[model samples]
Target: MTEKQFKKLKYYVIAITILFVVGFLLWEHLNGGILSHHLMHHSDYPSISNWWGLLILPFLAWLSTVRIEKRVTLQPDDAPVKAKILRVVLIGFFGMLVLSLVQSLSFSVGYESVAICLSLGLVVVGLFLPIYRAECIFGYVFGSIFFTGAIIPLIGILVIAGISWFSHVCIKPLVFRVIRAQPQ
Candidate 1:
C-alpha cells in the first residue's frame, strides 16, 4: 500500500474506534450502565438490537480487514478470508454465548468483575481470531461486549481511545520502518 493509503486507513481506524468507545459509554450511561439488561431480565428472545449488533459484525470485520490489506500490502494469497460472512457470524455467536454465560454466572456468583474479565476474554478471542483466521468482525462486536461489562464505562472508553491513538500514531509508523529495514 502507498503511504497515503496507510495514513488514510490509520485515520479511519482511529476515528471509528473512538466513535465506538464514546458511543458505548453513552449507551451504558443512558441505560443505567447495563448493556443487555433487557436480554438478562426483560426478554427470552433476543431483541432487534441484539440481532442488529450481530449483523454488523461482518461489516466491521470487512472494514478492518480491508484496511489491513491495504496498509500492509498483503497479497490476496497471504490472507484468504473464505466464507467470510458465515465465519464471522459463527464466531460472533460463540462470543455472544460466552458473554451470556458470563452474565448469568455473575448473577449467581455475585461478582461483576469476574464476569467482566470473562467478557474481555471473549474480546481477546475476537481480536486474535481476525489476526490468524482473517476474520475481523468479531473484534468490534466483542469489543462492544467487553466495554459493556466495564465497571466504569467512561474510563474504558478513554482507554480504548488512547490505544487507538497509540496504535495509529506510534505503532503504525514503527511497523513501516521495520518492514522497510528488512531485506527483500
Candidate 2:
C-alpha cells in the first residue's frame, strides 16, 4: 500500500504487539512462568519469550515473499521433523519480529533522517489489501514503513536480508540435512 497507509498499518501492528506483550508478561507474572519449561528449554537466551516466538514462523513465512514461483516445505521430513522445522522457523521469526519492532520504534522515535525507505512489505500489503480486501488489512498494518531516512531503511533491509541469509546458510541447511537424510 501507500506510505500513508503503511504508517497507519504499522501503528495498528505496534499497538497489537504492545497489548500482546503486556498481556503476556502480566499473565506469566501471575501464573509464575517466571521459571517454566518455556523459560528454560525453549529460550534461545535467558531473557526471551518462547510462546508466540515459536509459532510466529508460519506467519513469518507468509509474511515474506520467499520465492516468486516455486514453493517447498521448509524441511523435507516426516511429521516430527516438520514440527521441529516449524519450531526453528518460529524462533527465527521471533528474531525478525523483534527486530522489526525495534527498528520501527527507533525510526519513529529516535530517527533524524530526512529520507524515505520503501520496503518490500509495502508491495505485499498493497497487493494483499486489494486481494484480501480489508480482511487482511491487519497484515498490511505490520508490513513495513518509511518512518526514517534512507540509511535507517537500508539498515533494516540489510538486517532482514542478513538474518534471512544467515538463517538459510546456517540454520536451515543444517536442519534440513539432518531431516532429509535417510536413517541408517
The global C-alpha lDDT for each of the candidates, from Candidate 1 onward, is: 0.48, 0.39
* Residue-wise C-alpha lDDT for candidate 1, range 1-184, written one tens digit per residue: 4558656765675567556656665775687653542434347754333324433544444555565545345434333353354356456445544555555457546886786676466445433333222222234244444433322222333444355456656767899999999999
Provide the lowest-lDDT 10-residue window in model 2: 131-140
Candidate 2 segments whose C-alpha is farther than 4 A from its true place: 1-77, 111-155, 158-184
Which model scores highest in TM-score? Answer: 1
lDDT of 2: 0.39
lDDT of 2 by residue, 1-184 (tens): 3336535654564456556545554665588653222222235634333343223423333343232011124445356765564454444444434544554565457442311233445333333222221112222223322222122233344444555555656766788899889697
- In angstroms, how far off is 41's CA in candidate 1? 10
* Model 1: residue 50 alpha-carbon error in angstroms: 0.3
Which pairs clash (backbone N, Cα, C closer than 3 Å) in model 2? 1-126, 9-141
Instruction: Give the winner by lDDT.
Output: 1
lDDT score at residue 142, model 2, on the 0-100 scale: 33
Off by over 4 Å in 1: 1-48, 74-110, 115-137, 140-164, 167-184
lDDT score of residue 70 within candidate 2: 16
